[model samples]
Target: MDTDRLPGCYRHPDRDTGIRCARCERPICPECMISASVGFQCPECVRDGSGTGHAPAANVPRTVAGGVVPADPHLVTKILVGINAAVFLLGLVAPAVVVRLELLGRYVEYFGGPVEGVSTGQYYRLLSSVFLHVEWWHIGGNMLALWVIGGPLEAALGRVRYLAVYVLSGLGGSALVYLLTAPNTPTLGASGAIFGLLGATVVLVRRLRYEMRPVITMVVLMLVLTFVPFGGSLSVSWQAHIGGLVTGLLVGLGMVGPAAGRTRALVQWGTCAAAFLLAAAVVLVRTAELT
Candidate 1:
C-alpha cells in the first residue's frame, strides 16, 4: 500500500473501504459501513467512536434514537404535551362559544355516557373524552405526569410502541369506567393513559432491573395525588388510573415476553388497531341504545 496516501484503508487503515462513510467523509470497507441516517458510518464511529451522542439541541425540536440518559429520543412527550395544551385551549374557548351559540356539541361526555335516556348519539365521547378536561388543573397535572414518564417510556420502548401503550391504556381506562360508573356520571381526561404510562414504567424498571428510585418516587407522588383530598373536593378518578395501570401491565408483559425479539416490532401496531375497533364497537352499541 502507498504509505503517504493514508496507509490505512480508505474507510479504515486496518480495513479497506471499497465504500466511504456517508457522514464523516472517511473511507469505509464494506464490512465497516454500517447503515445510518444518510448512508453508513465506519466501524469505529459506529461502535462508540463518534462522540456526538444523539441529544436534542436546546429549544430545537429533533428526534433522538433511543432513550438515553441526557435526552430521550422518543418525542412522544413533546407531542403529547402539545396535544394536551391545544385541547385545553380549545376547551376554554369552545366553552364560551358553546354557551353563547346554544350548541349541544359543546359538552364532551366521557365513556359515551348513559346507555339510554334523552342523551343518545353522544357516542363519540368514548374517544373524544380522552382529550377533554374539566379544568386547567386537571389537564396540567395529567400533562405533567405524562411529560415525566412518556419520554422515558417512549425512549425505552420505540415511538410506535409508546403510542400503542398510550392509546390502549386510554381505551382500557375508558372500558373500566363504562363498566363501573353510573350511566349518568361524566368522566374525562388523559389520566387513564398517563396512569398506563406509570404502570408501564414500573414494569419496565422491573424488567430492566434499573434503579427503582426515580420511577418509584413518581409512582408514590401519583398515588398521593389520587387519594388525598385537596382544596375540599378532589376531582380525581382513581378508576381510570387503575384501568390505565391494567392496560400498561398487559402491554409491558407483551413487550418483554419471550416473543419480544421476534414479535415486538409489530405488536404495537396490532394493539392499536384492536383498541380502535373495540372503542368503535362500544360507541356504536351505546349510540344505538341511546337512540
Candidate 2:
C-alpha cells in the first residue's frame, strides 16, 4: 500500500523512484528525468530518441523530435555552396579528370564509357551523377541555385526532409534520363535534383501558407537557364530535370498538411513509396531497352 516504495531507477539502481517515464517504463527520480508535456523522459531518451515506431509526438515539432532541423541554416547553406564551388574550381584546374568525373561522353550515341557501364542499368547514376557536373559553369550554376533555394527549404523542411527531397528527385530524374535518352549518349549534372528541390519548394511554401511569389520567380528563372544550353549541347538530360521536378512535387505534397501525428505519418510513407516505385519502374524499362 506504499507507492513511495516503488522500484529503484532502472539506470541508477541506488536511487528511489520519484517519477515514471511513459516512454521507457523506467522509474526516474526528479533529478534523473525532465518533465515532458506527455510524460517524463530520460536525458538519453530525449537526445537519441526514435518515434514510437508509428505515430509521431504531436506537441513537439516533427523536425525537432526527428532531430532533422539544422542548427544553423546559413552555415549549412554556405558549406554546401562552398563544396560545389570548390569542385567546380577543381574542375577548371584539371580538365581531363573533370571530364571523366563529370561523366560526359565521347558522343551522343553513347554516354561516358566508364559511367555508361555504371549507368547502363540505371544503378550507378542514381546517386553518383549528382556529384558529377558537366563543366565549371554547370557546377557553378547548380551551386548558385542551391545557394538561393536550398537554405530556405532546409530551414523550412528540416535537413532530413530537404535532403530526402533532393536525393529522391535526383534519382527520379536520373531514372528518367536512363529511360528516355539514347543510351549511348553521356549526360551528367545535379540539375535534375536541383530542379526537384525547386518543385519541392513550390509544394512546401504553398503548404506552409507562405507567399510563393519568390519560389515561382526562381523556378521560372531556373527553367530558362536549363534551356539556355550551358553544357555545350542538348546532351544535358533535360528529361531528368523534369523527372526530378515531378518527384519533388509529389514528395512535397506528402510533406505538406498539418498532420504530424501517427495517422498522417502512415499516409505519407505510403504515398512516398508509391511515387518512388513508379520512378523505379520507368528506370527499369528504359534500362532494359538500352541494353
- Top candidate when judged by lDDT against the true structure: 2
Q: For residue 103, what is the lDDT in candidate 2?
A: 30
State the lDDT of candidate 1 residue by residue for 1-291, as single tens digits.
664342245634674233455556776543343444444455556555453355423212211212122244557678878877887777687764222221121234434541332134444455566767757777887788788788767765666667878878887777666655555656778888998888887886675444568788877787787888776767677777787787776776555432323344366455556656665565455444434
Top TM-score prediction, candidate number: 2
> So what's the TM-score on candidate 2?
0.66
Model 1 lDDT, residue 20, Cα: 56
Residue 47 error, candidate 2, Å: 17
Q: What are the per-residue Cα lDDT tens digits for candidate 2 across 109-201?
A: 224444333344336546566666646566777888887777767766666666677778887887777676656556677788788888988
lDDT of candidate model 1 versus the reference? 0.60
TM-score of each: 0.62, 0.66
Give model 1's TM-score versus the native structure: 0.62
User: Which sections of candidate 2 miss by over 4 Å?
Assistant: 1-68, 74-122, 228-236
Candidate 1: where are CA atoms >4 Å away?
Answer: 1-72, 96-121, 266-291
All models: lDDT? Answer: 0.60, 0.63
